[model samples]
Target: MQLFAFGLNHQTAPLAVREQVAFNVDGIENALRDLVENGAAKEATILSTCNRMELYCNAAKPEHAIDWLAEYHKLPRQELEPYLYTLPRDLAVKHSFRVASGLDSMVLGEPQILGQMKQAVRQAEQAGTMGILLHKLFQNTFSVAKQVRTETEIGANLVSMAAAAVRLAERIFPSIEEQNVLFIGAGEMIELNAVYFAARNPKRITVANRTLERAQTLARQYNGHAITLSDLPEQLAQNDIIVTCTASQLPILGKGMVERALKARRHKPLFIVDLAVPRDVETEVSELNDVFLYTVDDIAEVVKDGLEARQGAVKEAEVIIESGVSDFLHWMESRDVVPTIRALRENAEHSRRQELEKAVRLLAKGESPEKVLEAMSRGLTNKFLHAPTHALNQAHGKDRDNFLDVARRLHHLHNDE
Candidate 1:
């Protein structure tokens, strides 16, 4: 199987296209199964995040996988093809290593992509589409990611999405330490945002989720409060800052909800960061006079800092990634030889057994031991040389030249004996 990774990311596609093709947590399993079922991929793992929607696959043909992604998403292949980048063999391996290392992220050197990749692998495994190639790719990806993180200062000064949300809130409140911060959902992104905001020792931290029990569990870690989604309308007006990231297919906060909150607060500025891919906050909420809204894409400019300083580290990362890619491709190449190698060994063994039997019969029929041994050696040698010698004699034209050269090289090498 050939290794490949193809898709669009923050650098290649705008938020509109990215969101259109983005898969939520619920969609990953089906997408992976569909990829294999449709003959697009022999094995597949799709990584869908706020900034990227990539497919890492092992397949007989890369074209089939690319067409599958576009068709499966109902996107025009021509339109998506411009943004899509198909990396084959070594390049694909390098991309996987770099992506896992966070060198490919919009905000370079962010650790979250590693976790996102792990989640993708888990989903692929659950879907029963993760075969040896993908399994090894993911395993090597994790090792490379850990090496990059530990060996380089790539992750230093991490002004990630969670951190950027906190920065935007601090801009609104002057000091986040005095304001109440609310985090919606108990998912990984929300938990990360909660950790960042809670670091400021906010007046109070509240986690609101569809499940009150889940919210309470996450909230208790920060000495905070919890509430169900139903409590938002009653409790919304109380918070000064809100950060939300959920996998919901629909908007969690619409114009009606925020407008009501604004009136309840009598025009107090509310800082809201919607980190979800499809977006938890309604688009109209951005138009509100008192609401400050940002998204995963909006914070892209903020978290993208120290490009020049990190350039040195990025270059270092590229070198490591190249080494890793070459190694992985070498391993894949070796795997390709296994069946042929096994076949050749079996053929040799069959010839040896046939010759051995002939030698035993000659000895049993009262042939001299010395004569039997000599005959046995000659028989095995003749058997080994027979097929290739015959093929070389029969070969003609292009096959003649090639087999003649091959036979000459083999004879010369063993003729030394």
Candidate 2:
């Protein structure tokens, strides 16, 4: 089966497009089943984060997989076409390895992507969508990722997007110590941002989420406060730094709402880092002179230059990944021939067993053992040579030359012999 990866990511798609297509955990399993049944793929797994929405699959037709993604997201193929990237086979395997190893993350060398990928695999397994091909590919993916981390400085001296948010916040006010930071969402990205912001000992910290309990749990960790999403508009003016990452398909903050917050904050320079894939803040808010709009990709740019600081290790990482890619592809190739190999071995065994059974029966009937043994040896030789003899006679041209060589090799029928 051909392996393919088709979808959008931080590089190909803007947040507007990627967010529209992001799949939640529950949505992933259903989408995977839909793909397999729709003849789009035989095995599928979707890895959806705020920054990327990639579908990895084993398939006969890559286009069918693309169509499945478009149809499921209810997006027009024409519109989706611009942002979608399609990788076949080797490139697909390389992309998977890159993504899982944190090389493809918004923050280079971050470890979160590895964990996220493992979660995706577990979800695929639970849905029964992970087949031998996908299972082995991911098994190698994790191993390669681990090797990259350990063998190279790929993860060294890396600045996380969350940490960069804090850096940007420092630029707004002379000191983060005086400002109150409000983190919007309780997701991993938000949690990380909040932790970084809280370390500054902000005047206060608050977490607002769709669920009050989740918000409360996160807020309590930092000795701050929790509020439901409903409180955001009213509470917006009170915070100086706002970091948001949520799974909401729609914009959490509109331009008008933020404008109102800016008006209330009295033209305060609000440092806003929207880590959400689709975005927590509306695009129009970026137009505001006083508001800073930092997207996931925007944050990615800040840490990018620093990754060069660890360039000594990249060549080593490539070697490790190459070896892993070779091993994984070899395993994938073997899977295709496995059944044929089994059938061939069974055929050979069956032929020998039948001849041996006949020999044993003759001996049981008190026939001469020597004649029985000779007959069995002749039967075994004939059975072994029959298929190759037929193949050599039937094949022609390239097929004939190849099969003749194969047959000669099989029976040790060399010119010298």
Q: Best-fitting candidate, measured by lDDT? A: 1
Write the residue-wise lDDT of candidate 2 on 1-417 in tens digits: 788888888888887778788886657777778788888889988899877888889999889888877888898889999898899998899889989887777777788888889889998998888987888889889999998998788888888877788887787789898988898899888888877888899999989999999999999999999999999989999998888888787789999999999999899888888888667788999999789888887776677767777677777877888888888888878888989999999999999899989998999999999999999999989998788778878888999988978767876788666
For 208-246, candidate 1 gives per-residue lDDT tens digits of: 998899999999999999999989998999999999988
Highest-scoring model, TM-score? 2
Clashes of each: 0, 0
Candidate lDDT values, in order = 0.87, 0.86
Please give each candidate's TM-score: 0.91, 0.93
- Model 1 quality (TM-score): 0.91
What candidate 1 gets wrong by more than 4 Å, as runs, is 357-373, 391-417
- On the 0 to 100 scale, the lDDT of residue 78 in model 2 is 91
- Alpha-carbon lDDT of model 1: 0.87
Candidate 2 least-lDDT 10 residues: 297-306
